[model samples]
Target: MAERILIVDDAAFMRMMVKDILTKNGYEIAGEAENGQQAVDMYQEQKPDLVTLDITMPEKDGIQALKEIKGKDPEANIIMCSAMGQQAMVVDAIQAGAKDFIVKPFQADRVIEAIQKALS
Candidate 1:
């Protein structure tokens, strides 16, 4: 079965872009959130197989959301997304239990690769 994925980004366009790519590649879009707080809520409701999370967002940011999710479910699969130059945050995300990360202005292959690696 296709993996169910939740996408969390404050920008609707970003979420749409990711949804387009993942759907085209046969992944199921389980849900979407415009902020970290919403992401956490949706996660509990959906329990998706994976989540693509933006590091910068209003109402809590991705790192905080990641922490909340990981705290709730240690095995939660998440891939952090950020623009270039957020290395420190990326490292912090990894330390916080994110399985992998993808840079913004996303490349489809890169996103897929990260998700696959995280799932594996």
Candidate 2:
């Protein structure tokens, strides 16, 4: 069965780009969220196999949302996304429990690889 995935991003375009990649590769899209809070809420509802969270967002950032989700379900598979290529933020995200990281202007291959690796 395709793994259900929750996509969280403040930008609709980013979310659409990711959804297109994952669905085309046969992964199931559980839902989409526009902010960290929504991501947490949808997480409870969908209990997706994985989630791709944006590190920077309005309302709540990915780090906060990742913490909340991880707090609720330590096993949640989450991949962090960011447009800025900052090593500090990436390290912080990894320390906070992100299974993987994907840079913005995402390459379909990298996105697929990250998701697949995270699920594994």
Candidate 3:
């Protein structure tokens, strides 16, 4: 079965871009979130196989949401997304239990590779 994925990004364009890439590659989009708060809520409701989370967002940032999700499901699989130059945030995300991190202006292959690696 195709992996179910939740995409969390404040920007509508970014979410659309990710959804387009994953859907074209046969991954199922479980849902989309405009902020980290929504991401956490959707996570509980959908329990998708994976999550693509943006590092910066209103209400809650990716790192905080990641922690919340991990707290709820210790085995949750999450791939954090950040723009270039957010190395510190990336490190924190990894330390906080995110399975992987992807930089923005996302390359479809890289995104897929990260998700596959995280799942493995």
Model 2 misplaced regions, further than 4 Å = none
Candidate 1 residues lying further than 4 Å off, grouped into runs, are: none
Off by over 4 Å in 3: none
Taking all chains together, each candidate's TM-score versus the true structure is 0.98, 0.97, 0.98
Write candidate 3's Cα lDDT for 1-120 as tens digits.
Answer: 999999999999999999999999999999999999999999999999999999999999999999999999999999999999999999999999999999989999999899999988
Q: Least accurate stretch of 10 residues (summed lDDT) in model 2?
A: 82-91
Candidate 3: residue 66 lDDT (0-100) = 97
Q: How many pairs of residues collide in model 3? A: 0
**What lDDT tens digits, residue by residue, belong to model 1 across residues 41-74?**
9999999999999999999999999999999999
Q: List per-prediction Cα lDDT, in the order shown.
A: 0.97, 0.94, 0.96
- Model 2 lDDT per residue over 1-120, tens place: 889999999999999999999989999999999999999999999999999999998888999999999999999999999986667888898999999999999999999999989998
Worst 10 residues of 3 by lDDT: 111-120
